[model samples]
Target: MGDSIIGGPRIYSCYKCRNHVALHDDIVSKAFQHVCSGKKEDRQMMTGLHMVADVHCADCREVLGWKYEKAYEESQKYKEGKFVLEKYKIVKENW
Candidate 1:
């Protein structure tokens, strides 16, 4: 057999780490396991808001900033395995 298809709207890659995360996946639920019961900083950072703000790279573990609505638009300009421009999107504007 081949790989099974995971149902979701679409997967997105982290700009810093290139880690792929499905939009429909339970990212908040997963991050909670690490964010909670960890350090005070992490717990304070998590706030446990579910979708409003929650995203981290599973690879490099870099905390992705808010504004996921524009991830796809930004990623479209670059190919996979490409480096994310450091200066781009500093203002954290939406797509």
Candidate 2:
């Protein structure tokens, strides 16, 4: 998968800005999207049917995560309108 690699062997930064950063190493963390934009569609996920919009990095235009447009399942209702940004694993080293 795509990972930030602006030197430091594993230091990750925005593919475009290269200032703000995040790390990727098989760890997936959840995030919410407040801005940026993507199209919405119904997609079958592990949880169930979800109407989601792909959240892309404003700087890179890369699909980062997703925005839950609507959740059909009652239990999953809490996820509605929530965001899950690009999954990443943070690493520590020379900075």
User: Could you say which candidate leads in lDDT?
Assistant: 2
**TM-score for all predictions?**
0.29, 0.59
Question: Which number leads on TM-score?
Answer: 2
Q: Which stretches of candidate 1 lie over 4 Å from their true place?
A: 1-9, 24-38, 42-55, 65-95
Instruction: Give all candidates' CA lDDT scores.
Output: 0.31, 0.61
What pairs collide in candidate 1? none
Question: lDDT per residue, candidate 1, 1-95, as tens digits?
Answer: 11234443333455654455333233333321211111212222132322123334456655544322122234332321222212331222121
Write candidate 2's Cα lDDT for 4-91 as tens digits.
4455434444444453344444224343222365889999999999999987666666666677899999999988866665535212
Report the C-alpha displacement of residue 46, candidate 2, in angstroms: 0.2
lDDT, candidate 2, equals 0.61
